[model samples]
Every structure is written in structure tokens, then in C-alpha cells.
Target: MAWYDEAIFYHIYPLGLLGAPKENSYDGVTHRLKELDPWINHIKEIGCNALYIGPLFESVGHGYETTDYRKLDSRLGDNKDLKRFVKKCHDKGIRVILDGVFNHTGRDFFAFKDIKENREKSRYKDWYCNVNFGGNNEYNDGFSYDNWGGFNLLVKLNQRNPEVKDYICDTIRFWVSEFDIDGLRLDAADVLDFDFMKALRAVANEVKPEFWLMGEVIHGDYTRWVNEGTLHSVTNYVMHKALYSGHNDHNYFEIAHTQRWLDGMGGSSGQGFKLYNFVDNHDVERIFTKLSNKAHFTPVHILLYTLPGIPSIYYGSEFAIEGRKEKFSDASLRPALNIKDYKDSVKNNPATKLVAALGKVRSETPELSYGDYKELHLQNRQYAFSRNYDGRSVVVTVNNDDNDCMLTLPAGNSVEYVGALFGERITVNNGCIQVCVKANSGEIWVPAEKENKKKKLVELQTITEAGKISDASENKGASGTKEKSDTHSDINGIEADSHTEREEFEPSYEETSESNPAIEAKMNSMAESKKNSKIDSQLNSEAESRSDSKGNYEEGVIAGLQEAILAIMEKNGYVTDQMRNDVYNNTHHDSLVNWVKSFIR
Candidate 1:
């Protein structure tokens, strides 16, 4: 399976994340990135396996205007520090994707500088798109040159030139080989040369077949950019616009129709195209600001995670870090966040919990990642859709109206349906499940029976593979089904009775006095975690036992209360170690959740 097919992306604008100087300080401040090591666990806690770190190379400002590709930005760190950082992330099962600003470069780029000094005599005169020594330019650069989107600071590259193409391709190879990075997110991909992109894809795939190539396509047919040889995926701008507009307008059909077109549900132009789905990113206003009603924010995020395509969470967005891109500057949107302060605030932020839950659910559930799209119901302010792979299915329903709404699902046994969002058993009557969603809320319902069936099939496959089951046994299993196992399951799940197990397995390592220091350290951490969990459980037992005997002990009551808080946090999002520390050190997670719930109520 493709690493990114089911991956959750966490986009971090490094300059903002690191709080680096806006301009180049040329200081070897590699220690600043030590602050980010704590966030690696936070990323994994939220179920994201991929980190789409914004520009980290030597640059002028914002890390986008590139000055050097071979060297690391002194403001951020040296190459050694970056390699160590990436290794740490890889150890935690996180794949890193760097920002590829291939289309343009800052005017101070080495080649551009060379041209300025040598004029028409420069050997690299043909490197840029429209360089000319005609007259003094606006910035008094002694020449006029092609700039990207009328931005004089960002000079465009002549991608058609073989020398320029080779340089970009070689740089990509260097990063992949040197840093062992997984992929690249092409900057300004919409206007990038199609031929160059195809060549780049070839190079990336040749180096590493699993290397993912995603583009920042804002408009037009996304299929044109994400075909076999060009890009694996593009940003889903169409849905990003439709989601907010549809919710604000109270028109579910708008998004429903667009979704159908993208998923090929109703014979639309673009079919089966999975684009990067996001409500906000580095370039736009925060989703919290774009949303008309604050109540709709979670529902919109729900859709982003459940719908086709990979879901990306902009850094600091999960906590409702509000900002908007104003006319002259994006300073508001790209605010520098102190890691400590952000972690402290996250413990009290309810959105963080919700986003974490969605991330975990989206990652573990196969149907959500690679399932067939089917719209079961739609209305003015309400919508329902199902993602089915093999027999396993999950039905997602959203109610954006002011009043609660009842949605009737497809005919199924009552015992089959389980609420993914709330962890409640669904009520199915007469072959149909009646799901009542709260006003301005969304619920994801997964069929428990189907999941169990898939697991059984996997077990059978394992037995078969091990030579424990014969052809006759396999035939017997197939005959036990209602119909013949003729249909093929897609990349998502197992085929009915034609089961195939695709479980991820890690190599077993024995821990001893001779074990590697890193392995020993990890084992020690795991042991400590187990000890803490045991202590928590014992405390809970004491609380319940004391409650039955006398009323309750003070310590037991506090422990019980902490457990409750942790449960609530896990239900909403995976509670991290930092959250737990915050709970024991400062405020309670339950208090923040209760406060948010009280407002919604």
C-alpha cells in the first residue's frame, strides 16, 4: 500500500514553528529546533504519520524565497542538525516531506547574483526565464527579469532549459539520498511546467517508488496534474471552497454535488480523484475565521477527514489559532508559536481533542481511507454519506441546521451499527438504522458486525497461508456465505470470503544488557508507561472499593476524577503525555471539555 494513501499530514511552517528571524541571521542556532522534539509525540498522538514541513533551506524571508538548495538555512540549523531531526522523526514513524520551490528563486539566489555581476556574458544567462540587461529594474538590480505572479522578489526559473532542469532534479536526488526524505510538496504547482513535473516524478519514483509527489493545484481539472506520470495528488481547492460556502449558505447540495463529481458518484467529469483536503493552510485564513458558525467547525473537519483524499491539519489550527491573511501581510496567519505555551493551551482547548479523535479514527479505519463513496441522503442543511470497502462500511451523517435531525440509514441489523464519534450502540429497526444527530453536529457510524467479519476472514487467511486450511476448507467457508465470493475488494479492505490478510508487522528485538542504547531507552520508557498505567488502575479500583464501603477516600476520589477526565479526552482525541502532565500539574482536561459542552448545550 502507498504510505500516503492512508496517511494523515501535519503541515508545519518551520520558520513560524521555530520562530526564526524573518530575515537571514546567518547564525548557527541549531538548538532552537530542540524545542520541536517534544512535538514529535504530539504529532503521533494525533494519528498523523507524515510531516509536510514548510521550507527549511537557506532563504531570504519566510523560507519560500530560496537562496540556496544545497545548504541548510543558518537561521534554522546546519545540515547535521536537520539530519538528526529527521532521524528522530523517522524513529517515531513520521515521514518528512520538504517544500520544493522549484518554479522560482529569490533575486539574491547565486545564479541570479552571478548574472547581475557578469551581465550578458554570464554563462548562466539562460538559467532564468526572462533575464535581460536592458535597463535598471525596480529594485535597481541592473536588469529586468521574469518574476513569479508579479512578485519582483521571486524570479521565475526557465524550467525548459536542460541545465536548469538537471540542477533541480539533482537537488531533489540529493535530498532524497542524503536525508532519506519520503516526498515533496511542489510549490506553486499550478503554474509549474507540466514536462518538468513529469520528469521530476520520474526521478522521484526512480529513486524511491513509494515517493509521493503532491502539487498545490488551486484551479482547473485536478486530473490533468495528478495522472500517472505527473503528480500523485493535488490540493482539493474545489471542496475547500465548497465546504465553507455550502455550510454558510445552508446548502448541503452544493458540497454534495461537488463531492459526487470528485468521487465519480454521479458520472461527473473528475472521477475517483483523491486530492489533499484542508480548510486552512499556510496561504489562507484560518478555518475558524472562515466558518460562519463556530458550531460548524467540527462538522467541517469531520467531512475533511471522512471524505476522499488525505486530510492535513495546519500547525496550531487544531487549537483554533485564529488568524487571517490581510492585504499586505500574512503575519497574522503565520504567527510564531512557542511550543511550551501551545502545549499548555492545548490541554484546555476542546478542538484539539476532537481533531485528535478524528485523526485516530481516520487512520485506523480502512473504510475511511480507501472506500467507495455513496451519498445516502441529502437536504438543505443535512447530509449523509457512506464509505464502504468489502462488507465493512461506515456511514457519516452531518446536521448543520438549528434543530436536531433523524437520518434513516440502509437496512441492517441493530447489533451491527456502532457510533464512531460517541461510542454508543446504534438503534436499527426493520432493516434500517435511525440515527439522530444533534443540531450543528456530525456523527460517524461504523458497522461493528462487518468489522468482526473482516477480522474472521483475516484469521482464516492466516491459517490458509500457514497450510493449516485446505482447498476444501476454503470452499466450505465460501459456501457458508449467502452468495459466492466473486466480487473483488479494492485497495481498502478484504473480499467477502476471498480473504487476504495485510497486517503490518514490526521486527522483534530482544532487550538485554547488550542491546543498543536507543532500544534500551525505548524499552525503559515503555516499562515506565506500563507502571504508570498500573498505578492508575489500582487507584481507580481503590476509589470504587472505598465508595462501596464508606463514601470515598480523598486520594481515591481525586484519582477517579482524573481517570474520568482522561476518558473524556480520549473519546474526543488521544490524550498525550503532555496533557496528562498538565492534568496532574495544572488544570483538569474535564473542566475544559465540560466548559465547551456547556456552551454547545
Candidate 2:
């Protein structure tokens, strides 16, 4: 398995982290990059092993529109300074992942500029998209070219050109060979060509077989870019929105459905394909602003860590640093911060302690990394799920409601459970465990005693035999136990009489006598159904990855809805915040689309 499978990421917008100006300085200062050395311990303390540093390359502005691929951005440091910084990170047992903005380049990029100056005669004219000398240019360069997302300064590259592809591949190889980086987060990967992405993956694998390639895919089916020929993973924007919306709307069903649908999309392992999950990044508002209540932070962190993905925390988020993205500027979202700044902000904040504790829990738990997900129960403001691996299970329960809620676990083996957050001991009786989760809080429960290896072997054999013997196997056992239905004895060679007491534990179902073999048999049948459900869940999860057409259709519907909203806004002559909120909080996308269609008609 790749190290990223178990790794937790800490994302840093380097230019913002180092206090570099938004515009290029070309000052050639290296000292700002070194300030990260002191923060290495701070990163490790929160259980993050991977550092995803965004855009340290030479750029004209914001590091997205790159001018040079070979040199470091002069505003931050030189090549040597980066090498030293990377060395320090490696020495401290932290892996580095750089932001690869290969989709576009700045207008000042040498090759693009050459095409502009030389026009039709330039040999590098084909390096850019739609370079035409036939029309007047936006920048008055005597030619027109395609810019990324209508941004004239950010020129899109033509990867179809052999020379351009070769240049990008060589740049990737140079970074791997020189800095020994662990991974690359491809910027604007949604618009990037699939063939180019495959080639990029092959090149990165050739340099380092385990070199992770993640994409910045905001919409569409994630499996389109995360399958075998493309990237290792993509940003889990679906879950990101579901997460905050579930809290904001006080509807856990929204997120629960998303989790159930996507959790099994991770191939045969059903690990959900290791999405790069985050609550906030440089592109969005901070979690503090996203969440309606501050108390929901703990439960949100709990869900983030326990969900099937490689979770990440934006810089300063662990300490509740809040920032919102303005309409036309990202300056508020990505701010420069020193150690003193983080130190002062973290003081007296419970968010750090809560996030750190949750991070450590995720790091130590195997189920969180590679287990199959099965949502047990869900309501508008409460949810429960299980992560089971090799017969061991971890059950998670969350109550987003303002009042305490009691959850009755499905009937199963009588076992003990320990809360991952507080180490509180809980005992199960008659295959059922009931617990009350506090309002706006959650708990992670792990089996206190490991299952018996021999018993597991027996259960597997018995289940397989049941597939063939059908009712005979169950009948034979029933016949033997029928006479002693009133006696407490071994059923199927497993203990059935050990009961743990808790006055606080309330049973949702009616109590049955310990001597009732009929009740025991019924419970055992339910257990078998639960076991079959696990197998079905695994199959469903694998099938989920292959069902991309449905996702594509859904995306089309969403696009249509957005267009309808825009048209309506244009016609109405006013757009209110309530209308925006309605659009956002509408979990039933198709219903909203139909409503808009009717209103427009």
C-alpha cells in the first residue's frame, strides 16, 4: 500500500504562509521559507505526515500563472533554499507534495512570450492554445490566444503538442529527481486532458512508483479522474459540501446518503478510493464560518477523521482561524502567518486540542484507513455507522440535534466497546448496545475484546455450509436445542448466556427471557442477515465506481439548474441572499430543478 493510504495531510499556501506579496517581487529572498522549520514540530504534533505545499514555483502572480518551471518563485526563495527546506522536512520524517500547475502558464512565460513576440514565425507558436495572428488580442500583443477561464494573464497550454508534452514531463521529472518530492496535486485537473493525465501518471510512476497524483476536480464523477489510468485520488468536494451542509441544515441524512453512496466507490477494497477530504481549502470559506454552531466543530472533526478518505486540514484551521473568500479576492482566505501569529491565535482555543485528539485517533485506527463502510442508522439530526475490517468493527455515532438522542445498535455478538475519544468502557448484552450521544457531539466505539480466531473460523465455515445445506444445518442445531430451550447452554458452540448490566442502558426492543431459544434463534437470524448485508455492501461499493454515467447525468442536471437560476436572476432584476441560500440548501437537486423549470415556464 502507498504511504498516502494512511497519511494525514497539512496544506500550506506557501506564498501566503511565507508572507510573500501577491504580485511577484523578484527580490530573491530565501529566509521566509526557513520559517517553516520551527513549524515542523507543530505539524507532526497534530499527526500529519504529509505536507502539501501549494505553488512554490516561479510565477508572475499568485503562483498559479507560472512564468518559469525550472526556477523557484523569487518572491519566496531560490532553488537552493527550496532544496534545504525539503531536506529539513525529510530529516524530520515529513513528506512533501508540491502543487503542479501544468494546466496553464503566465503570459510572461518564456515560450508563450516568444509566441507573442514572433507571432506566426515563432517556432514555439504551437506551445499555447489558439494562437491566432488573424485577430486583435486582448493584451494588444498583435495576436490572440486562449486564456485559462477567461483570465488573459493566465494562458492555457496546448498539451497535444508533442514538444509541449515533452516539456511538462521533463519538468515533472526534474522536480522528482531534484527535490525527491512524494506527490503532486494537479491544479485545474477537471479541464486537463485525460490522455495527458495518464501520461503524467505514468511519468510520475516511472520516477517513483508510489508517487501520488491527486487532482483538483471540483465537479463531475470523481472516478473519471481517479481510476487506474488517471490519478490516485481527487478532492472530495461532494463530501466537503455535504459535511458543512449537513451541519448547517441540521440534516445528517444528506451527508449519510453521500457517504453510503461514495464510501464503497473505492474499488474492490471498498476504501472509497482515498479521496483528499477537507473541510476548507484556500478556495473556500473557513470551517468556522461554514458551520452554524461552534459546538459542531468536534463532531465535524470526528466525522472528517473517521470518513473514508485522506483527510487534510488547512493551515491555521486546527486553532479555529476563520477567514472568508470575498467575491473577487482571495486575500482574506489565504493570509500570511508567522509562528507568533499561530501561537497567539491558538491560545485558549479548544479546537486545537479537539482536532489533535481526533487526529491521533485516526492515525492509530486501522478501520479508519481501510475498512468497508456500513451506515446503520440515520435521521435528520443524528447518524450512526460502522467500519468493519476482518471481523473487527468500529461504530461511530453522532447527534447533531440540540437534544440528546439514544441509539440502539443492531443485534449482534455480546461484546464490549471502548470510546475512541474518551476511552469510556461500554458493554453489550444480547447482541445489542444502546448509548445516548450528547447533542452536537459524537463518539467512536471500538470492540474492547478481539474476536476469537477459532470462533471466526467456525462462523465462516457454518455460513458457507448454510449456503448449501440451507435449512438443514439450522434445523439440526434447532432439534438439539429444542429439548433444553429453558436451559442456559452453549448455542452453536458460542456463549449465549453472559449478560452485562447497566441501569443507564435502555433497550428499545422488549426484553426476552434468557431461556428463550426462539428469541435467541431469531436474533441469530438477524445477525446472519447483517453479515450478508456486509457482503452486499462490498459488492455495491465496487459497483459504485463503475456507475459513472449516472453521475454525469446528475452533473448535467445541476448545470441546467444553475443556468435556470442565473436566467431567473437576470429576468427578476434582483437576487436575494434567501434565494442563494435556498439554492444551496436544496439537497433534493432534481426537485429544485423541476421547481425552477415550472416557475420559469
Can you list the residue pairs that collide in candidate 1?
Answer: 411-431
Query: What do the candidate models score in CA lDDT, each in turn?
Result: 0.68, 0.68
Give candidates' CA RMSD values in order: 25.0, 20.9
Instruction: After superposing candidate 2 on the true structure, give the runs of residues whose Cα lies further than 4 Å from its correct spot.
Output: 263-272, 344-348, 411-414, 449-601
Q: How does candidate 1 score on lDDT? A: 0.68
- Per residue, candidate 2 scores C-alpha lDDT tens digits across 1-601 of 6798888999998776665654565655555677778788888877788899978888866688788898888877778888888888888888899999888898788998788678888999898888878654325566666755433557779988889888999999999888888889998788898889989988977999689999988644678899879899998876887788778778786677666546445442244488899998876677877787767877888899887888999987887666653322344456555555445222234676566667777877788888877778877788888877767788889888779898898623437887766666677877777888878888888777554211211000000000011221121221232111100011100111111111012121113212233554565455555544543454344335433545665554554454454443333222334445545444345444343433211
Task: Give the per-residue lDDT digits (tens) of candidate 1, residues 9-82.
Answer: 99987766665655565645555555678888888877789999868889876676799997777777778777
Best by TM-score: 2
User: Each model's TM-score?
Assistant: 0.72, 0.74
The residue pairs found clashing in candidate 2 are 266-273
